[model samples]
Target chain A: MKLQKPNDVMLQVSMRVITLFIFAFSFYLFLAGHNNPGGGFIGGLMTASAILVLYLAFDMKTITKAIPFSFTTMIGVGLLIAVATGIMSMLFGYPFLTHFFDYFLFPLFGEVELTTALFFDLGVYLVVVGAAMTIILAIAEDDK
Target chain B: MSNLVILPIIIPFIIGAVLIIFAKHHRLQRVISGFTAVGMLILTIYLAFLVYQDGNIVLEASNWPAPFGIVLVADMLATLMLLLTSIISTACLFFAFQTVSSDREKFYFYPFFFFLIVGVNGAFLTGDIFNLFVFFEVMLLSSYALIVHGGTKYQLRESFKYVIINVFASALFVVAVAWLYSVTGTLNMAHISQRVAELEQTGVINVIAILFFIVFASKGALFPLYFWLPRSYYGPPAAIAALFGGLLTKVGIYAIIRVFTLIFYHEPTFTHKGIIVTIAGFTMVLGVLGAVSQFDFKRILSYHIISQVGYMVMGLGIFTPLAVAGAVYYIVHHMIVKTALFLFAGATERITGTTDLRKMGGLIKTHPVLAWLFFISAISLAGIPPFSGFFSKFPIILAGFQEGQHVISGIALLVGLLTLFSMMKIFSYAFWGKQKHTSEQAKTPIGKLLLPIVPLVALTIILGIAAEPIFQYSLLVSEQIMDPSIYIESVLKE
Candidate 1:
């Protein structure tokens, strides 16, 4: 039976397997961004690409039903997170966006290095995802 | 060193983001936005006072040193801009709260409004040229959203043109910034000023200066490049129109003044006297002519915004302490008076359901307050004596004649007469003709609508009456800005 003829059955099955791997890789990219080439913006794009693949494999209706959240509000939440991170520095009597870092011992991870830049990066990551998804989805769903 | 400089930018940014959550909740959005506006007003007033008393207040972002990391500088000029921004924005917010439909307000209007404020204030305060571009993007982004908020066919069409023009201008702005950076080997404006002074503005520098002028002129609605302004400004809601009319072009003029004075001052004969003044003359004459031809109230006000911008740049073109001071005073006066006139246009449109002056008549009999208030503001804008416009124009024209720039000065006076003529035409057509509206249409309650505009009208009158002190304050600001060393020292100081 040639499953690759016209319908998206095989493509859909493959996307299901590929989607999980993409999510893991994107998160890895986000985490490794502290010292490497990967960062929030690129990682967020990667995640958005994975989501785009899901929308491609399935129709918009199915994918949106599975993930029922407004991308516009997601952008707002992301921006709030980002601004709050900057204001945190202000609350600590430092200048705006003045990030600080220290290493603390953990049970299994030992003395893991952590920094405020990571949180800032997280906000950027969320915003990029939200923005990218919003634009892509809006264009795809446009009736005109 | 102070952290106060970024507060204006940050507060709006935070509130803008916060307001996005409550987009559907109209009353809450208005309440929060109103409080933010008032808070910003008080903060800027205090900040302006502080900057006036103490020299410049510089904020090094994230504990970064000056000339390396980004810095926000609140000098007298920046603070004065911030003060005007807060005042205009506060009034615009209340006007929007009263006049804007809930449908449009629900479409993330308050968020973008606050973001526009963030961008304007940020543009005023940033010490780095690149940061200025970022803030410009922020401003243009929000303005794009606000312009097309209602998604009308006309709004979409006009705003598309608006967005394209601004985007092209922004691309040129980026190129100019990159070119300036490569030549000076610095992105910090003060450092660029220092390097420019070192190089003494050679031929290459003059080219870059003209390129910068073209970019900013497009944004500020200068002659030959202001084709995209009037129609686009005529599309949006009057509250948004008033805000854009009052504030947006001034940001462009502010950038022009900042760069021309600080970085490009060494070759004023080539750049300022030769190029800017020539452009300013044409901008004034052509812009006023466009106003004369327009029969729509909003269209007239929109074209007038372009003409008034020419005056501000003309002040800068003269490059004297008093002339630049006149420009500053004119910026404030034009901002207040222009916003009020736009609101009056909105008031009449609300009462009559049309902006066509030919369709509107006998507003003087019905809406007496709006008619008289608009008349006062219109005459003030026409450079009538004992109003803000006369004082602001007097110094610039005086400086022009003193500097032997009789041609451009004469052009300015002619434009002023045409301005008065067109204004009187608006008065006659809209207020003195046959009463076209039904008596019930005339009874449309504009008392509450007029509330937000009263302050601005009063400001125009007060600015006129208190021109001496206001002119002196602007003189202080102009002296601080004209002398580049003060700004350079403040920003680059360890």
Candidate 2:
């Protein structure tokens, strides 16, 4: 299961444009996650897809070596973060999975404020990326 | 309160993480897993009794406010499922102790098993739909590994299909969650119910409900989506088979019950009361036919898992408290007896080296203990008189009649009789006829190998003898589920 060769020039150019658009959209989604529609899940998927396209186009062996950490551990860490965000409520005298309060502020860039839900969404983003990558890569390795 | 919500998942998860480092040492891994399983059982039972006294325990993770943060709520339904999972996990682990080879056990099986329990428990307890999807992936990924643990040609081939289908289902799950969030603007289950109630029953919600149903239907192995269970289950050893048989489908059932009764109750005319009954009846009839067609001992049991799920779902479709309570009670009884029955198949297979009923005979004379235990569970599975299965079904059928669903009632009755016939076929072919095996092999007897099934066998009888209190408890669970305002208020209350 060697990685498929990189897509030719036309395909690569189209993929690059798509990747850039996704990155910008994903950032917007993550920034507007709280009180608005988008969040970390969409953002994470966008980022992961961008990475995945590159990996699939370039060699997987190169992609595998380029990564700095294990996808499975990233999943574990993501889940732990998600779970930990929920656990933080208990420390402040709430029940399991109770979220702390939040505040909203509109800034020059956009509305910006800290919310535990943002943390939860981030955790979700990580899990989605970790799980997708793990399954895809594991299947690829198995084929090999 | 936290103990009630998080302990069940946390202990198994911590132990599972630790086992990864010790995966090479079979003996050490077994000892740790054994201790963890026993701990989980004790914790689950104590928690069940706690819920019995104090009502449901809703733990908001990290003490966040409700409707804003995720919650892990333990109502009677969650605790009951947890108790059954712990029981099945313990029994299956013991059976695995005797049967699974050291080489296979050493390959991170114990850790993966623990992780699987974490996913199962999380799925039952989660208060958010998206979080449920996360837990589900956690569970299924581990299952993918465990199912093909040894990487046999058959295991790999079948599990690949299983993995691909579930992956696709999970993608649909995300899609559904995204759509739901767009419509309701909330992911908290209780909050979704509250919001959906204020809005009109739009066509969009109906489409979303069907989408959610499709995802769970595939998971639960409902009428049109059940082809994956039988073949994929055949890949694992008996112990894992028993675990999957007992708990996995129930998770799907739990999700169905939770969503339909809580969030989707806003439009029962289109969603809950109508679709559930229609699909459930078909699920029961078709599943039994599949069972009747199969000759393999394990295959028959696997098919019956689908059929029995129908009865539980039928109770839900009835929409009356009596019927729903019956479904809850039926779930408890079925999970226990079904796991025991599968373990018995595993033992018989261990002794005879074949699951094909045509390949062996007359086990009652040589291994009377195994035969009798199998007999009790089989009879219970068939819903015979004096067994918990019958008691559970009686209320369901009575509730069905009371609700004027005579056709469904009639189908359920016919399914019950066919279930009895399928179980009897196994009893006669594998236990009652002439001894076809060599004398030396017969002397080894399946009796010693069958000891792990003793506790579950005893549990079936106990459930039968103490049917009154348990049935009353089921009534309470159904009442709680039906009037979920209490659940929502507690979770969302400031």
Most accurate candidate by TM-score: 1
Query: lDDT tens digits, residues B1-494, model 2?
Result: 46357889877876776676566789998999999999999999998888878877887665556777778888788888999999999999988988889989877789899999999999988898888999999899888888998888989999988899899999999999999999999999989988888776678988898898889988998888889999998888889989999989889888989988888877776675688888999999999999999999999999999999999989988888999999999999999999998898888887788999998799888888888888999999898878899889999999999988999999999999999999999999999888887787787755555667999999999888899999999999999999979778767764
Tens digits of per-residue lDDT for model 1 on A59-94? 878899998887777778888888888889888889
lDDT score for candidate 2 against the true structure: 0.86
DockQ comparisons of all candidates to the true complex:
0.71, 0.26
Q: In candidate 2, how many clashes are counted?
A: 18
Candidate 1 lDDT tens digits, B1-494: 66788899989988988888777899899899999999999999999999888889998998888888999999999999899998999988899988889998898899999999999999999989999999999999999999998999999999999999999999999999989988989999999999989888888899899999998899899988999999999999999999999999999999999999999999888888888999999999989999999999999988888888999999999899989998999998998999999988888999899999989899899888888999999999999989998998999999999999999999999999999999999999998889999999988998888888999989999999999999999999999989999999988873
CAPRI-style quality class for the chain A–B interface of candidate 2: acceptable
TM-score of chain A of each: 0.90, 0.78
CA lDDT scores, all candidates in order: 0.91, 0.86
Residue B362 of model 1: what lDDT? 92
Q: Name model 1 segments beyond 4 Å from true.
A: A1-6, A104-111
lDDT of 1 at B201: 89
Q: Which candidate is the best by lDDT?
A: 1
